[model samples]
Target chain A: MTRLVAIDWGTSSLRGALLDADGKVLEERSDARGILKVPQGGFPAVFEALFGDWMGLEGARCLISGMAGSKQGWVEAPYCACPAGRVEVGRSIIDIDVRPGSRIAIVPGLRDEHDGVPDVMRGEEVQIFGAMSIAGLDEGVFVLPGTHNKWATARKGRVAGFRTYMTGEFYALLSQHSILARTLDADAPLDEAAFLDGVTRSENGHGLLHNAFGTRTLALFERMATPELSSYLSGLLIGEELRTQSLQAAGEVVLIGASALTQRYALALRATGTATRTLGAEATWAGLHALSGFLDADRNPP
Target chain B: MTRLVAIDWGTSSLRGALLDADGKVLEERSDARGILKVPQGGFPAVFEALFGDWMGLEGARCLISGMAGSKQGWVEAPYCACPAGRVEVGRSIIDIDVRPGSRIAIVPGLRDEHDGVPDVMRGEEVQIFGAMSIAGLDEGVFVLPGTHNKWATARKGRVAGFRTYMTGEFYALLSQHSILARTLDADAPLDEAAFLDGVTRSENGHGLLHNAFGTRTLALFERMATPELSSYLSGLLIGEELRTQSLQAAGEVVLIGASALTQRYALALRATGTATRTLGAEATWAGLHALSGFLDADRNPP
Candidate 1:
């Protein structure tokens, strides 16, 4: 029997997994039904349509994370202040009114306001907690690579602080919309050498705004081919992120994300003389599972 | 008589000026007809439509600069190597065939192959040459700010060496396409304080990939208003460009570009402790006219 339903509802995609009481995932499903593309029936209706069987089941709870918790999401789950963990996130879950007599809990995102500038993350917080749980560590730096890459520090089983970098988003914009697009091959395979070369360039301390011109000049001079330009750009961006962020202080960096991007980050980090460990999407599942434990405790106090 | 038609044909716009035999401006005109927008009739047809009367005038020659010399322009006016001045640029102009027995010369761009990567500029070279002519500087650094900001060094009245920074292009992409776009007010008036704040941030030695995130967080936390974000971003990018390109050695920097942008660069350079002198787009006219002199000389030997 399905004990719980965990969903990662992001900006552009929705992923759901049904888990047993022991937290073993029984079935998984995903769709392009992101919050940005909700159907005529609103988020509740769309959630029902996508996970009908799992819903309305007796004693089975549904947990949601990611942008679904934002102001633009199904229900605004106000962010919990940072230096938080599973209990902090769990206690902050807000209920969503839905049909079929279901108990739906939306995981609140984490916010770090100490930096003078407010930085917040919804889905990545779950990944952070999950990576911490999986790595069996109480303190570490977790690098979650995505459209907006996140760098979170975990201390004593709680997120200490984190910052967001628009690395992937800027890469997409540069590769697709800027003049540098003229010299890139979007469809080409990853060129590791060029990507590493970009990482090497980043290490030189030449600011990114200046080094980026090399993307064109290198191609123009035949020093780097068009196909390699994409990877080189990727390396440069990720490398700069590593160079500037305070991720080096952590003993071992934990990279949690999809393998393709995580691998690239790992390569960049390793090249910079830092060791990294990779965790897949299951880390999110594990994080959601751990947070669900808090929900169960709230529903039934000992 | 309309002695010469000097055109600055760039990627997105075309500007033309009519001059007499003594290089005095007779009339000026500009249009959105950049090389990127030529219709099915081709460049000659577009040129004729834009400047019809001046084209067929007796002894009215045409001189074109900028991307009109690029591979995608009307005809590729190959780049003249650096350590070159008016004479080199003039001799390198390639002829374009048009109606009315007209003689048209497209100015060659400059290429600096001294650095491992090849750096090239087309119309800006004309402006640099023009700035030299106007300021009477035999040697100095001339910064031409635009889509691709060029930092050119002149020694003995010739372009010594230069570097290209994608500052403007990167700013455009970040403000219009990246996630930070949501926090910016593109139509807002310039904010000098916020812009200087960005310059101050650049001085902290944090790489741009890290600094750019401030645009988002500051706005999110209400520390920076939307309108101010644009100028702050501008300062951040321009500051990075100035920091990385090594323009400090020159005694006095000559900034040649549009007034508004040059003013901003002037502020940025000043904040960085460097003095600047501004030159308007008339410099391009002067450079093209000086280059046009070469064509007249070829017609009637000295």
Candidate 2:
């Protein structure tokens, strides 16, 4: 049985899963030492320290995903252009020789173009695949909410294309650094009512730049409290994001991310009368495991 | 002749003009000590140091505008509900008894409501009035480009209503703090072609949040250079701001702000086939001088 060490290494944190050939997780580990935290040329050392023992298992192979493939990561695993599925992505994996006999590789990110401008994604491609595998979906729309929220479309087992929105980052910037920060509680939990209000407000023909200012004015007029303002701001941004999307009435959006963020997206999608199914970190593990199949094919070409 | 000291004290800097009764700027002084930098309870001292001599002139009255009237400013001058012009604003001035036999007052900001959501502006109201005064027109569309860009309307010498866009602040935050900052030169001079590309990109119906991420991909693909990315981002934001405005074909926009910002706005406006006239710091001085007439009428009512 070929054991697998699957890793999701992002900008700020890292997680690893050790799985048996059946794609069943045997053990999981995580760390705050993401790509950014890794010292200059220290990726190999960090990777060895965190998952070295797991890799020692007989026939164990490792596949790293996310920012680990970014130029700033362990090694620059160049992006795989879109209309890519497991096979296309697997074929593009770049190997990094950590040791003379180690079998380790990084999954390439994906890029799609729109009107001559390109949009790129790092790790969410894995989650999309995982979500598809676990949900029995071959074609669907998926939303991954994070610092950079991505809306992706999959068709016939391949990621057709996707677009990125700075919704989450804008929320952070406005709620912590902009003037609205003065009147908002940055850490406050989601206030569904206030958030919905913001979402509804976003549909009012006024753009986000104008609607965002309302966050400050709402506080100044004592219309909304400080705790709810953050959620309201989040809603406004998420709502603006939704405003740009053309979701079909019968289509369901598969949301992949931490529950804290996906739940918000689920709520926002629900508000738009669209249904959603959410997948968490397990999707990342499942995705990396599924992609590991390509490694075996690469070793023994058809 | 009643000597006048007209001051525009905002968040980051302070400028004062010693004006004659005819609203002629005799001597002007400026400092980096905006309302935010003024030490707590130091407004009196700062005022005395910078323009106290001008205020000391016989019968000189000071009219302070901008954030100096906010809750955090020298004193909270409650906002005057809109449909406000020189008379309404002057009548609502909040006095701060600076010294015995001294006249020092802060002009109240303006608030307008749209569908229950409120939009407010402090310093820009003065600029709109000044723009109107200098342009020899009572009713027109006025845009003040700054930290919080205001799009205001005037009718019969009164500011009918306005909306605010956080374009400048968003540009600062995104260029200085957001992920796009990594690939951009935040202080690059405006690249007209790149900027126009952004403006044109925004018209594609993809919202700002989504279009903004293109900044990164454009750089990643080597399609756009680093310095041009900031200007492109600026164009995207200003373009989004313009998208929300409903400008009439025959109407002209009066832009008031520092030349650098207004020039960019003028460029964006021109892209939409709109004619614009740009004004500078002189607008603020002229605005306060024009409003001084209201102060006299307040003391001696009809």
lDDT computed for candidate 2: 0.89
Over 4 Å off in model 2, which ranges? Answer: A297-302, B297-302
Q: How many backbone clashes does candidate 2 have?
A: 0
Best by TM-score: 2
* Candidate 2 lDDT over residue span A1-302, tens digit each: 68999999999999999989878989989999988899999998898899889888889899999999998899999889999988888888889887667789999999999999998998899989898999999999999999999999999888999999988899899988899988999899989999999899999988998999999999999988888999999999999999999897438999999999999889999988999998898899889988887776444322
RMSD (Å) of each candidate, 1 decimal: 2.6, 1.6
Candidate 1: Cα lDDT at B228: 94
Pairs that collide in candidate 2 are none
**Minimal lDDT window, size 10, model 2 chain A:** A293-302
Q: After superposition, how far is residue A272 of candidate 2 from its true place, in Å?
A: 0.9
B1-302: candidate 2 lDDT, tens digit per residue: 69889999999998899989788889888899998899899989998999878877898988999999998899899998989988888788888887788778889999999888899999899988888888898998999988889999899999999999999999999999888888899989989999999999998887999999999889989999988999999999999999888896438999988888988889999989999998988899889988776565355322
Model 1 agreement with the true structure over A114-190: per-residue lDDT tens digits:
33657889889998887777778889989999988888888899999887788888788888898788889766778
